[model samples]
Target chain A: MGKNNVEQMILNIPSDLKYLGAVDAAIQDLAREFSFSPDAINDVSTALVEACSNAIEHGNHFAKDKRVVVTLRFNGGDFVATVQDEGRGFDFAKALRDEAGPDPMSERGRGILIMRAFTDDLKFKCDDKGLTVELTKLRGGGGDAGQ
Target chain B: MKITQREVGSAAILDLNGKLTGGPDADAFRDVFKSLLEQNKKHIIVNLEKVSWINSTGLGILIHNYNTVRGAGGDMVVMHASERIESILYVTKLNLLFKSFNSEDEAVRSFTAAR
Candidate 1:
Protein backbone atom coordinates (compact mmCIF):
# COMPACT_ATOMS: atom_id res chain seq x y z
CA MET A 1 0.00 0.00 0.00
CA GLY A 2 1.19 3.47 -0.83
CA LYS A 3 1.43 6.18 1.80
CA ASN A 4 -0.88 8.28 -0.37
CA ASN A 5 -3.62 5.70 0.00
CA VAL A 6 -4.73 6.90 3.40
CA GLU A 7 -7.99 5.69 4.94
CA GLN A 8 -9.67 7.31 7.89
CA MET A 9 -12.61 6.15 9.99
CA ILE A 10 -14.20 7.81 12.97
CA LEU A 11 -16.35 6.48 15.80
CA ASN A 12 -18.21 8.57 18.37
CA ILE A 13 -19.89 6.78 21.26
CA PRO A 14 -21.11 7.39 24.76
CA SER A 15 -18.75 6.77 27.66
CA ASP A 16 -20.00 3.25 28.05
CA LEU A 17 -17.88 0.10 28.17
CA LYS A 18 -20.50 -1.78 26.14
CA TYR A 19 -19.34 -0.11 22.90
CA LEU A 20 -15.78 -1.48 23.22
CA GLY A 21 -16.59 -4.42 20.96
CA ALA A 22 -17.42 -2.05 18.11
CA VAL A 23 -14.03 -0.37 18.46
CA ASP A 24 -12.27 -3.71 18.47
CA ALA A 25 -14.16 -4.84 15.35
CA ALA A 26 -13.31 -1.67 13.46
CA ILE A 27 -9.61 -1.93 14.32
CA GLN A 28 -9.48 -5.56 13.32
CA ASP A 29 -11.06 -4.84 9.93
CA LEU A 30 -8.76 -1.94 9.19
CA ALA A 31 -5.65 -3.85 10.24
CA ARG A 32 -6.66 -6.74 8.03
CA GLU A 33 -7.20 -4.39 5.10
CA PHE A 34 -3.65 -3.13 5.62
CA SER A 35 -2.38 -6.68 5.47
CA PHE A 36 -1.02 -6.58 9.00
CA SER A 37 0.09 -9.90 10.38
CA PRO A 38 -2.32 -11.61 12.73
CA ASP A 39 -0.15 -10.83 15.74
CA ALA A 40 0.13 -7.22 14.66
CA ILE A 41 -3.63 -7.04 14.25
CA ASN A 42 -4.13 -8.44 17.72
CA ASP A 43 -1.61 -5.98 19.12
CA VAL A 44 -3.35 -3.02 17.52
CA SER A 45 -6.77 -4.21 18.60
CA THR A 46 -5.65 -4.80 22.18
CA ALA A 47 -3.78 -1.49 22.49
CA LEU A 48 -6.65 0.53 21.05
CA VAL A 49 -9.12 -1.13 23.37
CA GLU A 50 -7.01 -0.12 26.34
CA ALA A 51 -6.82 3.43 25.07
CA CYS A 52 -10.59 3.64 24.63
CA SER A 53 -11.16 2.10 28.03
CA ASN A 54 -9.02 4.77 29.63
CA ALA A 55 -10.86 7.47 27.71
CA ILE A 56 -14.20 6.12 28.84
CA GLU A 57 -13.31 5.38 32.45
CA HIS A 58 -10.58 7.81 33.52
CA GLY A 59 -11.08 10.66 31.10
CA ASN A 60 -14.83 10.70 30.76
CA HIS A 61 -15.43 9.07 34.13
CA PHE A 62 -18.24 7.09 32.49
CA ALA A 63 -20.45 10.15 32.62
CA LYS A 64 -23.54 9.60 30.50
CA ASP A 65 -23.33 13.02 28.91
CA LYS A 66 -19.66 12.66 28.06
CA ARG A 67 -18.51 11.14 24.78
CA VAL A 68 -15.49 9.26 23.51
CA VAL A 69 -14.34 9.79 19.95
CA VAL A 70 -12.05 7.37 18.17
CA THR A 71 -10.34 8.15 14.89
CA LEU A 72 -8.52 5.44 12.94
CA ARG A 73 -6.08 6.28 10.20
CA PHE A 74 -4.32 3.81 7.99
CA ASN A 75 -1.39 4.91 5.89
CA GLY A 76 0.57 2.33 3.99
CA GLY A 77 1.71 -0.12 6.67
CA ASP A 78 1.07 2.13 9.64
CA PHE A 79 -2.16 1.98 11.59
CA VAL A 80 -2.89 4.94 13.85
CA ALA A 81 -5.77 5.34 16.28
CA THR A 82 -6.67 8.29 18.47
CA VAL A 83 -9.05 8.08 21.42
CA GLN A 84 -10.46 11.39 22.69
CA ASP A 85 -12.49 11.89 25.83
CA GLU A 86 -14.29 14.98 27.10
CA GLY A 87 -12.65 15.37 30.47
CA ARG A 88 -9.48 16.59 32.12
CA GLY A 89 -6.73 14.06 31.62
CA PHE A 90 -4.17 12.75 34.11
CA ASP A 91 -0.43 13.37 34.20
CA PHE A 92 0.86 10.96 31.66
CA ALA A 93 4.51 11.85 32.29
CA LYS A 94 4.28 11.48 36.02
CA ALA A 95 2.53 8.19 35.69
CA LEU A 96 5.27 6.85 33.45
CA ARG A 97 8.08 8.23 35.57
CA ASP A 98 7.04 6.14 38.53
CA GLU A 99 9.80 3.55 38.17
CA ALA A 100 8.30 1.36 40.84
CA GLY A 101 5.19 1.15 38.63
CA PRO A 102 1.96 -0.19 40.05
CA ASP A 103 1.69 -2.86 42.70
CA PRO A 104 2.00 -6.26 41.09
CA MET A 105 -1.25 -7.31 42.73
CA SER A 106 -3.18 -4.15 41.97
CA GLU A 107 -6.23 -4.58 39.75
CA ARG A 108 -6.04 -1.16 38.07
CA GLY A 109 -3.20 1.10 36.75
CA ARG A 110 -2.08 -1.48 34.23
CA GLY A 111 -4.11 -0.11 31.32
CA ILE A 112 -1.48 2.44 30.37
CA LEU A 113 1.28 -0.09 30.66
CA ILE A 114 -0.57 -2.52 28.40
CA MET A 115 -1.25 0.21 25.85
CA ARG A 116 2.41 1.18 25.78
CA ALA A 117 3.58 -2.38 25.44
CA PHE A 118 1.43 -3.44 22.45
CA THR A 119 1.88 -0.36 20.29
CA ASP A 120 4.92 0.90 18.44
CA ASP A 121 4.24 4.44 19.44
CA LEU A 122 1.98 6.04 22.04
CA LYS A 123 1.32 9.78 22.32
CA PHE A 124 -0.90 11.85 24.57
CA LYS A 125 -2.32 15.33 24.28
CA CYS A 126 -4.47 17.18 26.79
CA ASP A 127 -6.39 20.30 25.87
CA ASP A 128 -9.31 22.33 27.09
CA LYS A 129 -11.77 20.03 25.37
CA GLY A 130 -10.33 16.75 26.62
CA LEU A 131 -7.44 14.34 26.40
CA THR A 132 -6.56 12.40 23.27
CA VAL A 133 -4.35 9.33 23.25
CA GLU A 134 -2.80 8.34 19.95
CA LEU A 135 -1.49 4.83 19.32
CA THR A 136 0.47 3.72 16.28
CA LYS A 137 1.50 0.29 15.11
CA LEU A 138 3.28 -0.87 11.97
CA ARG A 139 2.37 -3.83 9.84
CA GLY A 140 4.65 -6.86 10.26
CA GLY A 141 6.02 -5.35 13.48
CA GLY A 142 4.30 -7.98 15.60
CA GLY A 143 7.44 -10.14 15.23
CA ASP A 144 7.03 -13.89 15.53
CA ALA A 145 3.51 -14.94 14.58
CA GLY A 146 3.68 -17.86 16.94
CA GLN A 147 3.87 -15.61 19.97
CA MET B 1 -19.70 -12.93 29.82
CA LYS B 2 -21.23 -16.30 30.75
CA ILE B 3 -19.84 -18.35 33.61
CA THR B 4 -20.72 -21.98 34.19
CA GLN B 5 -19.58 -23.61 37.38
CA ARG B 6 -18.79 -27.28 37.90
CA GLU B 7 -16.89 -29.27 40.47
CA VAL B 8 -14.03 -31.59 39.73
CA GLY B 9 -12.81 -33.27 42.90
CA SER B 10 -12.32 -30.37 45.31
CA ALA B 11 -11.79 -27.64 42.72
CA ALA B 12 -14.59 -25.42 41.42
CA ILE B 13 -14.03 -24.57 37.76
CA LEU B 14 -15.69 -21.57 36.16
CA ASP B 15 -16.00 -22.03 32.41
CA LEU B 16 -16.16 -18.53 31.06
CA ASN B 17 -17.45 -17.57 27.61
CA GLY B 18 -17.57 -14.18 25.87
CA LYS B 19 -15.66 -11.02 26.71
CA LEU B 20 -14.65 -10.52 30.35
CA THR B 21 -14.35 -6.76 30.03
CA GLY B 22 -15.88 -4.68 32.76
CA GLY B 23 -19.54 -3.65 33.11
CA PRO B 24 -22.21 -6.26 33.69
CA ASP B 25 -19.67 -8.97 33.18
CA ALA B 26 -17.57 -7.78 36.13
CA ASP B 27 -20.60 -7.77 38.39
CA ALA B 28 -21.60 -11.24 37.31
CA PHE B 29 -18.09 -12.56 37.88
CA ARG B 30 -17.95 -10.99 41.33
CA ASP B 31 -21.28 -12.51 42.23
CA VAL B 32 -20.09 -15.94 41.19
CA PHE B 33 -17.07 -15.65 43.46
CA LYS B 34 -19.31 -14.46 46.24
CA SER B 35 -21.59 -17.46 45.78
CA LEU B 36 -18.61 -19.80 45.72
CA LEU B 37 -17.21 -18.39 48.92
CA GLU B 38 -20.58 -18.70 50.60
CA GLN B 39 -20.71 -22.33 49.56
CA ASN B 40 -17.24 -22.86 51.07
CA LYS B 41 -15.82 -23.68 47.65
CA LYS B 42 -12.44 -22.00 47.89
CA HIS B 43 -10.36 -23.78 45.31
CA ILE B 44 -11.21 -22.05 42.01
CA ILE B 45 -10.05 -22.52 38.45
CA VAL B 46 -10.97 -20.04 35.70
CA ASN B 47 -11.23 -21.70 32.29
CA LEU B 48 -10.72 -19.09 29.57
CA GLU B 49 -10.77 -21.32 26.51
CA LYS B 50 -13.91 -19.72 25.09
CA VAL B 51 -13.30 -16.15 26.16
CA SER B 52 -12.72 -14.08 23.03
CA TRP B 53 -11.60 -10.76 24.51
CA ILE B 54 -10.27 -9.25 27.73
CA ASN B 55 -9.02 -5.76 28.53
CA SER B 56 -7.42 -4.05 31.52
CA THR B 57 -10.78 -3.77 33.19
CA GLY B 58 -11.32 -7.46 32.77
CA LEU B 59 -7.90 -8.06 34.27
CA GLY B 60 -8.94 -5.85 37.15
CA ILE B 61 -11.98 -7.98 37.73
CA LEU B 62 -9.83 -11.09 37.74
CA ILE B 63 -7.39 -9.57 40.17
CA HIS B 64 -10.18 -8.45 42.44
CA ASN B 65 -11.67 -11.92 42.44
CA TYR B 66 -8.28 -13.52 42.95
CA ASN B 67 -7.65 -11.35 45.97
CA THR B 68 -11.07 -12.08 47.36
CA VAL B 69 -10.56 -15.83 47.00
CA ARG B 70 -7.10 -15.68 48.52
CA GLY B 71 -8.38 -13.61 51.39
CA ALA B 72 -10.96 -16.30 52.02
CA GLY B 73 -8.12 -18.87 52.29
CA GLY B 74 -8.81 -20.08 48.78
CA ASP B 75 -6.84 -19.94 45.53
CA MET B 76 -7.61 -19.02 41.91
CA VAL B 77 -5.82 -20.14 38.78
CA VAL B 78 -6.50 -19.68 35.06
CA MET B 79 -6.31 -22.09 32.16
CA HIS B 80 -6.55 -21.92 28.37
CA ALA B 81 -5.88 -18.20 28.08
CA SER B 82 -5.57 -17.09 24.48
CA GLU B 83 -2.38 -15.52 23.19
CA ARG B 84 -4.02 -12.12 23.37
CA ILE B 85 -5.11 -12.60 26.96
CA GLU B 86 -1.74 -14.03 27.85
CA SER B 87 -0.09 -10.99 26.35
CA ILE B 88 -2.06 -8.74 28.66
CA LEU B 89 -1.23 -10.87 31.65
CA TYR B 90 2.43 -11.00 30.74
CA VAL B 91 2.58 -7.26 30.22
CA THR B 92 0.99 -6.52 33.58
CA LYS B 93 3.15 -9.20 35.25
CA LEU B 94 -0.02 -10.79 36.54
CA ASN B 95 1.24 -13.96 34.97
CA LEU B 96 3.58 -14.21 37.93
CA LEU B 97 0.75 -13.83 40.39
CA PHE B 98 -1.76 -16.15 38.68
CA LYS B 99 -0.68 -19.63 37.77
CA SER B 100 -1.77 -20.66 34.26
CA PHE B 101 -2.29 -24.03 32.68
CA ASN B 102 -2.70 -25.31 29.15
CA SER B 103 -5.10 -28.18 29.79
CA GLU B 104 -8.11 -28.83 31.96
CA ASP B 105 -6.63 -32.02 33.38
CA GLU B 106 -3.49 -30.25 34.49
CA ALA B 107 -5.43 -27.35 35.96
CA VAL B 108 -7.79 -29.64 37.83
CA ARG B 109 -4.91 -31.77 39.05
CA SER B 110 -3.11 -28.69 40.34
CA PHE B 111 -5.56 -28.20 43.20
CA THR B 112 -5.01 -31.77 44.35
CA ALA B 113 -1.28 -31.61 43.70
CA ALA B 114 -0.95 -28.48 45.80
CA ARG B 115 -1.81 -30.44 48.87
Candidate 2:
Protein backbone atom coordinates (compact mmCIF):
# COMPACT_ATOMS: atom_id res chain seq x y z
CA MET A 1 0.00 0.00 0.00
CA GLY A 2 2.76 2.44 0.78
CA LYS A 3 4.80 1.91 -2.38
CA ASN A 4 1.83 1.74 -4.69
CA ASN A 5 1.14 5.46 -4.96
CA VAL A 6 3.87 7.15 -2.98
CA GLU A 7 7.07 8.37 -4.53
CA GLN A 8 9.97 9.26 -2.26
CA MET A 9 13.29 11.08 -2.60
CA ILE A 10 16.13 11.81 -0.23
CA LEU A 11 18.78 14.52 -0.14
CA ASN A 12 21.84 14.58 2.06
CA ILE A 13 23.57 17.93 2.49
CA PRO A 14 26.67 18.81 4.43
CA SER A 15 26.25 21.14 7.40
CA ASP A 16 26.90 24.21 5.30
CA LEU A 17 24.60 27.14 4.61
CA LYS A 18 25.61 27.24 0.94
CA TYR A 19 23.72 24.00 0.28
CA LEU A 20 20.40 25.55 1.30
CA GLY A 21 19.80 26.80 -2.25
CA ALA A 22 20.02 23.27 -3.62
CA VAL A 23 17.58 22.05 -0.97
CA ASP A 24 15.08 24.72 -1.94
CA ALA A 25 15.43 23.96 -5.63
CA ALA A 26 14.93 20.24 -5.07
CA ILE A 27 11.80 20.79 -2.97
CA GLN A 28 10.42 23.23 -5.54
CA ASP A 29 10.88 20.65 -8.28
CA LEU A 30 9.13 17.99 -6.24
CA ALA A 31 6.26 20.33 -5.41
CA ARG A 32 5.92 21.18 -9.07
CA GLU A 33 5.74 17.53 -10.02
CA PHE A 34 2.88 17.18 -7.55
CA SER A 35 1.16 20.21 -9.15
CA PHE A 36 1.07 22.20 -5.92
CA SER A 37 -0.08 25.75 -6.45
CA PRO A 38 2.42 28.58 -6.61
CA ASP A 39 1.62 29.63 -3.06
CA ALA A 40 1.88 26.09 -1.79
CA ILE A 41 5.25 25.75 -3.46
CA ASN A 42 6.47 28.93 -1.80
CA ASP A 43 5.31 27.83 1.65
CA VAL A 44 6.92 24.43 1.29
CA SER A 45 10.11 25.93 -0.02
CA THR A 46 10.36 28.40 2.86
CA ALA A 47 9.56 25.73 5.45
CA LEU A 48 12.12 23.36 4.01
CA VAL A 49 14.77 26.07 4.09
CA GLU A 50 13.99 26.82 7.72
CA ALA A 51 14.06 23.15 8.73
CA CYS A 52 17.29 22.52 6.86
CA SER A 53 18.87 25.68 8.21
CA ASN A 54 18.00 24.69 11.77
CA ALA A 55 19.38 21.22 11.21
CA ILE A 56 22.63 22.57 9.87
CA GLU A 57 23.05 25.31 12.46
CA HIS A 58 21.55 23.96 15.68
CA GLY A 59 21.62 20.19 15.23
CA ASN A 60 24.83 19.82 13.26
CA HIS A 61 26.51 22.91 14.72
CA PHE A 62 27.88 23.69 11.25
CA ALA A 63 30.35 20.86 11.66
CA LYS A 64 31.76 19.72 8.36
CA ASP A 65 31.71 16.11 9.59
CA LYS A 66 27.96 16.28 10.14
CA ARG A 67 25.24 16.06 7.54
CA VAL A 68 21.57 16.94 7.34
CA VAL A 69 19.24 14.52 5.57
CA VAL A 70 16.02 15.56 3.95
CA THR A 71 13.41 13.05 2.82
CA LEU A 72 10.44 14.02 0.70
CA ARG A 73 7.46 11.86 -0.14
CA PHE A 74 4.25 12.42 -1.98
CA ASN A 75 1.53 10.07 -0.86
CA GLY A 76 -2.06 10.06 -2.01
CA GLY A 77 -2.01 13.72 -3.06
CA ASP A 78 -0.30 14.93 0.11
CA PHE A 79 3.34 15.85 0.59
CA VAL A 80 5.55 15.02 3.55
CA ALA A 81 9.09 16.13 4.24
CA THR A 82 11.48 15.31 7.03
CA VAL A 83 14.73 17.02 8.03
CA GLN A 84 17.09 15.10 10.26
CA ASP A 85 20.29 16.08 11.99
CA GLU A 86 23.08 14.28 13.80
CA GLY A 87 23.38 16.34 17.00
CA ARG A 88 21.51 16.24 20.26
CA GLY A 89 17.86 17.27 20.06
CA PHE A 90 16.35 20.43 21.44
CA ASP A 91 13.30 21.24 23.58
CA PHE A 92 10.45 21.23 21.07
CA ALA A 93 7.69 21.81 23.63
CA LYS A 94 9.40 24.89 24.99
CA ALA A 95 9.89 26.22 21.49
CA LEU A 96 6.19 25.79 20.73
CA ARG A 97 5.14 27.53 23.91
CA ASP A 98 7.46 30.40 23.17
CA GLU A 99 5.99 30.78 19.71
CA ALA A 100 2.52 30.95 21.22
CA GLY A 101 3.48 34.10 23.11
CA PRO A 102 2.81 37.59 21.72
CA ASP A 103 6.23 38.83 20.87
CA PRO A 104 6.01 39.80 17.23
CA MET A 105 9.11 41.95 17.43
CA SER A 106 11.42 39.24 18.62
CA GLU A 107 14.12 38.38 16.12
CA ARG A 108 14.59 34.74 17.11
CA GLY A 109 12.25 31.72 17.56
CA ARG A 110 10.16 32.47 14.48
CA GLY A 111 11.61 29.75 12.29
CA ILE A 112 9.63 26.95 13.94
CA LEU A 113 6.57 29.11 14.07
CA ILE A 114 6.75 29.77 10.33
CA MET A 115 7.12 26.05 9.66
CA ARG A 116 4.17 25.24 11.89
CA ALA A 117 2.07 27.94 10.28
CA PHE A 118 2.79 26.81 6.72
CA THR A 119 2.58 23.04 7.05
CA ASP A 120 -0.55 21.04 7.78
CA ASP A 121 1.18 19.01 10.48
CA LEU A 122 4.54 19.56 12.19
CA LYS A 123 6.22 17.14 14.59
CA PHE A 124 9.61 17.07 16.20
CA LYS A 125 11.32 13.83 17.18
CA CYS A 126 14.32 13.67 19.46
CA ASP A 127 16.49 10.88 20.76
CA ASP A 128 20.03 10.30 21.92
CA LYS A 129 20.95 10.12 18.25
CA GLY A 130 19.65 13.46 16.96
CA LEU A 131 16.61 15.54 15.98
CA THR A 132 14.15 15.21 13.12
CA VAL A 133 11.46 17.65 12.03
CA GLU A 134 8.52 16.29 10.06
CA LEU A 135 6.31 18.52 7.96
CA THR A 136 3.14 17.73 5.99
CA LYS A 137 1.24 19.72 3.39
CA LEU A 138 -2.03 18.59 1.89
CA ARG A 139 -3.08 19.21 -1.70
CA GLY A 140 -4.52 22.51 -2.97
CA GLY A 141 -5.40 25.74 -1.15
CA GLY A 142 -2.98 28.13 0.55
CA GLY A 143 -1.89 28.52 4.15
CA ASP A 144 -1.61 25.43 6.37
CA ALA A 145 -2.74 22.70 3.99
CA GLY A 146 -4.98 21.13 6.62
CA GLN A 147 -8.61 22.12 6.82
CA MET B 1 21.96 37.59 -2.07
CA LYS B 2 23.88 40.25 -3.99
CA ILE B 3 23.48 43.51 -2.13
CA THR B 4 24.24 46.99 -3.43
CA GLN B 5 23.95 50.06 -1.26
CA ARG B 6 23.54 53.74 -2.00
CA GLU B 7 22.56 56.86 -0.13
CA VAL B 8 19.09 58.31 -0.46
CA GLY B 9 19.31 61.44 1.67
CA SER B 10 20.27 60.15 5.15
CA ALA B 11 18.75 56.73 4.44
CA ALA B 12 20.75 53.85 3.04
CA ILE B 13 18.97 51.87 0.37
CA LEU B 14 20.09 48.27 0.04
CA ASP B 15 19.08 46.63 -3.20
CA LEU B 16 19.16 42.85 -2.88
CA ASN B 17 18.97 40.59 -5.87
CA GLY B 18 18.62 36.80 -5.67
CA LYS B 19 17.55 34.50 -2.86
CA LEU B 20 18.43 35.83 0.60
CA THR B 21 19.02 32.45 2.17
CA GLY B 22 22.02 30.93 3.84
CA GLY B 23 25.60 31.98 3.20
CA PRO B 24 28.73 31.80 5.28
CA ASP B 25 27.55 33.67 8.37
CA ALA B 26 25.58 35.69 5.82
CA ASP B 27 28.70 37.81 5.72
CA ALA B 28 27.79 39.77 2.65
CA PHE B 29 24.63 41.10 4.27
CA ARG B 30 26.22 41.68 7.64
CA ASP B 31 29.07 43.63 6.12
CA VAL B 32 26.79 46.01 4.29
CA PHE B 33 24.69 46.76 7.35
CA LYS B 34 27.86 47.21 9.37
CA SER B 35 29.13 49.74 6.90
CA LEU B 36 25.85 51.62 7.05
CA LEU B 37 25.98 51.80 10.81
CA GLU B 38 29.57 52.97 10.73
CA GLN B 39 28.66 55.70 8.33
CA ASN B 40 25.97 56.79 10.81
CA LYS B 41 23.33 55.91 8.24
CA LYS B 42 20.83 54.33 10.58
CA HIS B 43 17.70 54.57 8.45
CA ILE B 44 17.76 51.67 5.98
CA ILE B 45 15.51 50.59 3.18
CA VAL B 46 15.92 47.07 1.83
CA ASN B 47 14.63 46.80 -1.71
CA LEU B 48 13.45 43.23 -2.27
CA GLU B 49 12.07 43.80 -5.75
CA LYS B 50 14.50 41.39 -7.35
CA VAL B 51 14.70 38.85 -4.56
CA SER B 52 12.82 35.75 -5.62
CA TRP B 53 12.87 33.90 -2.34
CA ILE B 54 13.79 34.10 1.36
CA ASN B 55 13.63 31.73 4.32
CA SER B 56 13.77 31.85 8.09
CA THR B 57 17.47 32.47 8.15
CA GLY B 58 17.05 35.34 5.75
CA LEU B 59 14.26 36.78 7.84
CA GLY B 60 16.42 36.37 10.91
CA ILE B 61 19.18 38.28 9.21
CA LEU B 62 16.80 41.14 8.52
CA ILE B 63 15.43 41.13 12.05
CA HIS B 64 18.88 41.00 13.57
CA ASN B 65 19.91 43.96 11.50
CA TYR B 66 16.69 45.73 12.35
CA ASN B 67 17.44 45.50 16.04
CA THR B 68 20.97 46.66 15.53
CA VAL B 69 19.79 49.72 13.68
CA ARG B 70 17.06 50.43 16.21
CA GLY B 71 19.50 50.07 19.05
CA ALA B 72 21.63 52.70 17.37
CA GLY B 73 18.66 55.05 17.20
CA GLY B 74 18.02 54.25 13.55
CA ASP B 75 15.45 52.10 11.72
CA MET B 76 14.96 49.63 8.87
CA VAL B 77 12.16 49.12 6.39
CA VAL B 78 11.52 46.75 3.50
CA MET B 79 10.12 47.56 0.11
CA HIS B 80 8.98 45.62 -2.94
CA ALA B 81 8.77 42.15 -1.34
CA SER B 82 7.51 39.75 -3.95
CA GLU B 83 4.17 38.12 -3.37
CA ARG B 84 5.77 34.92 -2.13
CA ILE B 85 8.25 36.63 0.18
CA GLU B 86 5.40 38.74 1.49
CA SER B 87 3.58 35.56 2.31
CA ILE B 88 6.50 34.34 4.38
CA LEU B 89 6.62 37.63 6.28
CA TYR B 90 2.89 37.51 6.86
CA VAL B 91 3.03 33.95 8.13
CA THR B 92 5.78 34.80 10.62
CA LYS B 93 4.09 38.06 11.63
CA LEU B 94 7.26 39.87 10.65
CA ASN B 95 5.18 42.05 8.43
CA LEU B 96 4.14 43.74 11.61
CA LEU B 97 7.70 44.27 12.81
CA PHE B 98 9.40 45.71 9.78
CA LYS B 99 7.44 48.47 8.16
CA SER B 100 6.85 47.67 4.48
CA PHE B 101 6.42 49.93 1.53
CA ASN B 102 5.34 49.22 -2.01
CA SER B 103 7.77 51.49 -3.78
CA GLU B 104 11.28 52.81 -3.33
CA ASP B 105 9.97 56.36 -3.47
CA GLU B 106 7.55 55.68 -0.64
CA ALA B 107 10.22 54.03 1.45
CA VAL B 108 12.65 56.86 0.93
CA ARG B 109 10.02 59.43 1.67
CA SER B 110 9.16 57.65 4.90
CA PHE B 111 12.67 57.96 6.25
CA THR B 112 12.90 61.64 5.37
CA ALA B 113 9.40 62.36 6.52
CA ALA B 114 10.16 60.99 9.95
CA ARG B 115 12.69 63.72 10.70
Q: State which candidate has the highest DockQ.
A: 1
> What DockQ class does candidate 1 belong to?
medium
Tell me the DockQ of each model, to 2 decimals: 0.62, 0.53
Residue-level lDDT of model 1, residues A103-140, one tens digit each, is 97888888778887888788899999999999888764
Determine which window of 10 residues in candidate 2 chain A has minimal summed lDDT.
A138-147
Query: Candidate 2 at B104: error in angstroms?
Result: 0.8
Tens-digit lDDT track for model 2 on A1-147? 242289999999999888988988998988888778877887888888889989998899899999999999989768899999998988888887775634766656777877887888889999876899999888853554222
Q: Return the TM-score for each candidate structure.
A: 0.94, 0.90
Query: TM-score of candidate 1's chain B against its reference?
Result: 0.96
Give candidate 2 regions above 4 Å deviation. A1-4, A99-102, A141-147, B22-25
Q: How far in Å is the alpha carbon of B18 misplaced in model 1?
A: 1.4
Q: Whose TM-score is greatest here?
A: 1
Q: What iRMS does model 2 reach?
A: 3.2
| Top candidate, metric lDDT | 1
